[model samples]
Target: MNFKSIITSFSFTIVFAIYTINSQNTIGETEVFTTTNQAVGNITFTDTGDLVYSHHPFFSPENRVMIMDAKTKTSKPFPNKAWNTPRTTDDNYLSNVLGIRNDENGIVWMLDMAQRDHVTPKIVGWNTKTNQLERIYYLPKSVVPKHAQPNDMVVDTKNGYFIIADEGIGNGGDGTNAAFIIVDMKTGKTRRLLEGTRTTLPENTPTVINGKHLAVNGTDLLVGNDGITADANFEYIYYGPLNGTKIYRIKTLDLVNEDFTVTELDGKIETYSEKPNNGGMSIDIAGNIYLTALETNSVAVVLAKDKSVKTMVKDANMVWPDGVSYNHVDGYMYVSAAQVNKGAVFNDGKDLSTKPFYIFRFKPITKGVSFR
Candidate 1:
């Protein structure tokens, strides 16, 4: 990420990477909250409105789970314990609770990944105000040292700490670690970064998914770092790398510095480009940085100012999108489409979006966030 400090600061990461590649979200500003996104199933919001969310078939070794009800968008089936095998395609079967964090006492901090040899892979907590289930983080086998794989997470509830991303080759092509894990959601404590850190390898470029090469044996096709978004005065941490075109950060006291020596904090890295997509990120309330860029079928934005990158929205139904949320009390923005290269190991098996994997809602032409 510090490729010669971005090739000698490349003019301050190229004018903030051209504001993160022309960051746009033009909806004529001011639309204070709106949802009920068709097919939305994994969301959260409630003062007393009861908008909880869950639905994931994405890491689908099949057996998708569910639980929705964002103001009667209606949904149910949400099994726990890695969704206990509804029919087993193996891989814990439960996928995509894809990192959600909310606080100020409403309590919502979850990040799920289950499929550790089809079981035992956890880092959980969900108490949307005592609706149940809290704490079950296990992964000290060197944080899944049996071929690592942990995705999308971020929770630093003011020093409780968390940061996970280990997009280590999945969708068959089967394992060979690539990491970034650091947890301590109050002593569940863990650590492992850039596992084999090949410059945090990823950027083989030439992804397609529903149309072709979703990369497998030509660079793991891609490797590591899925998503981590936490900013809005939370003081930095916006990550991306699932074939990343550059989007990074390092400073939560040097990525939770445990007293240096992960090679001097992976040599203190930093590069924040914008041209990344493959589901993983969410941070709004004017800290804009939402993601999903499945090869430009589009849905991207990364602007915490001085770090601007944009593509705000590019319809083609924003396909392949995979999980995002920033409701901010009704200024809606949620996305999901666990196509994941229409699986069958990156589509040589058929799934190129004839449609049925969707969950989108928009109206974001940002001025950050306008909550009234």
Candidate 2:
């Protein structure tokens, strides 16, 4: 497996320091930036659009969650004990922020699924500005049925609740129970919604990689879509099961009201799609949906009102986009190439992603609402 044979679509344009690397038999290059290296996990933006994110460090006792200037492109880990409990469910550092978002009040929140085997797996949050930890936003292990894991989340700041999607299968794609949980920011209570919808789904759509269906985990990786955000209007919540083709939504009021059944909530699914994607999902202030789809080898966008889809930028730079952010100050859109599914766990010991998982910001789509 080499570059020329496996990779068919690649970007010829080079605007920044770029290099070519092998990503699963395909040759790809990315916009290079200087930031502390730890496998970058998930990224979000402050109301001003400054870059804030977490990374998976190899040598540190704990992972780093830091802030950066998206423009100058610099980053530093947050002050220790300043961000919040770096611990997990059973009592360990809460590492890996799969999702991050800032609310209207300017609170930066994350749905952190800490590594429990290293400690206990759990979800918790911290206010970015105050650096205060809210330890109670997570669901009790007793509340989860069995072998259930909480992955990513979407905050409903107005209604005071955040919706979490369960991929069931963790990074290993095994033993995770699928379901969604709603956290009532007011009461600090959590409720479960559709968890496995994103996990149990079969790989109905295949990504073109070297003209072969890309496979991760010995089985073509599918199901358990991750990434979510509330509509800018705060009227509806938009989300996707990481691998599922459709983007779904439901009224914020309905999500927090446990009285409504998941089946009833299913009626609101909007099925937004440009193509099948298996990466982080987010929306901008104008309500545009962004997807880092490997299938298209591009970062994609969907208009909220009409469900119109467009490939924002598709060259070599867009490989395996994971998390996306909006820079309000600079007026640009950003995305990452986690090539998450390309890890050996998913790709049968073969890493299918191009080296240097990236972070990129295109000009800007300044028209509508952003769902992030």
Candidate 3:
């Protein structure tokens, strides 16, 4: 009796351990790579592996952008302090920024919303390799209308263009005015397309986090045309609203062509896949689009072939994951936990965000564009 009982107990314990190991493996590995005091808006990596990120303007941080040392974890105003300092006169300082990406040439491109100082919205590019200001392309009223919030962008150096998603909720307008803004790098010409289209506008449903609907002053949050990304080949642009349930993509060729009218371009958009209310997105070489599933506190992937949505990883602390950027140096994807839902605007004028915001990283199924 003693020998048989001992043998059976040992086997049961071994099988239980194996089952536990397998269950943990299916969830994947996520590391808390960095922590910061300021709520981060977005993040990208330079060729040298330095971490660069935007200080979300919603909280009115002292600096608009900062660069951190990978090993030391020290932070400094990116480019220099002057670029972040504000002046009464019109200057080159970044007013407010949310979108940022690193190009193949090592240029850290920042999308400055210009909401703080009432200046023109613009894209500021800082070359990391050369350590100088590369360029700044201002968006006129025609290209970026009033109440337009140019939140995120995809830089397609392969196609010689930069595309920005205007959420159209900057000051007070609803999500109906949301659209896409295309910039011609060579000529600096810009055009607004698909304004008020179904693909660009947010779903009428409120973005409910946990069990409560996000709201400010009595109006439910209506973020539009938020997360956006382009394929590695720059063939198609994929995007959806922050309060959306479906993702959409359009051919790059049809988007840039002047021949297509507004109605024609609207027809060219294809419903790519279903998704949860997400913040930022990045696409891999294999066409897997990684999205930050805000409602579920997880990262989801939309497969390229069949377009099935799957949860890749989850973390209870990763609230309101705002940005996803691929790091070519480490072959991992970095994501920022913006914690926007904890901000005062959403919580009856009381900021509930905890100190020391977190940045997480995990290995992707395949390699992705570092510049995205």
Best by lDDT: 3
Clashes of each: 17, 40, 0
Q: How accurate locally, in lDDT, is each candidate?
A: 0.57, 0.57, 0.88
Worst 10 residues of 3 by lDDT: 19-28
RMSD, candidate 1, Å: 20.5
TM-score of each prediction: 0.29, 0.76, 0.93
Flag clash pairs in model 3: none
**Tens digits of per-residue lDDT for model 3, 1-372:** 599999977875675355335435333457799899999989998897888999988899999999999889999999789999999877689999999999989999999999898888899999999899999998989988887899999998988998999998988878888989999999899999888888889997688888988887888888889999998888999999988999999998889888998888888989989998888999988798999988877888887768888777778788888899998998989988889999998888899999889999887766777688
Tens digits of per-residue lDDT for model 2, 216-323: 544564545466666667787766665566776767776677776767766656555544655666666657676666666676767556776665666564555666
Quote the lDDT for 156 in model 1.
67
Worst 10 residues of 1 by lDDT: 27-36
Decoy 2 TM-score against native: 0.76
Could you tell me the lDDT of residue 305 within candidate 3? 69
Candidate 2 yields a Cα-based lDDT of 0.57
Displacement of the residue 154 alpha carbon in candidate 2, Å: 1.2
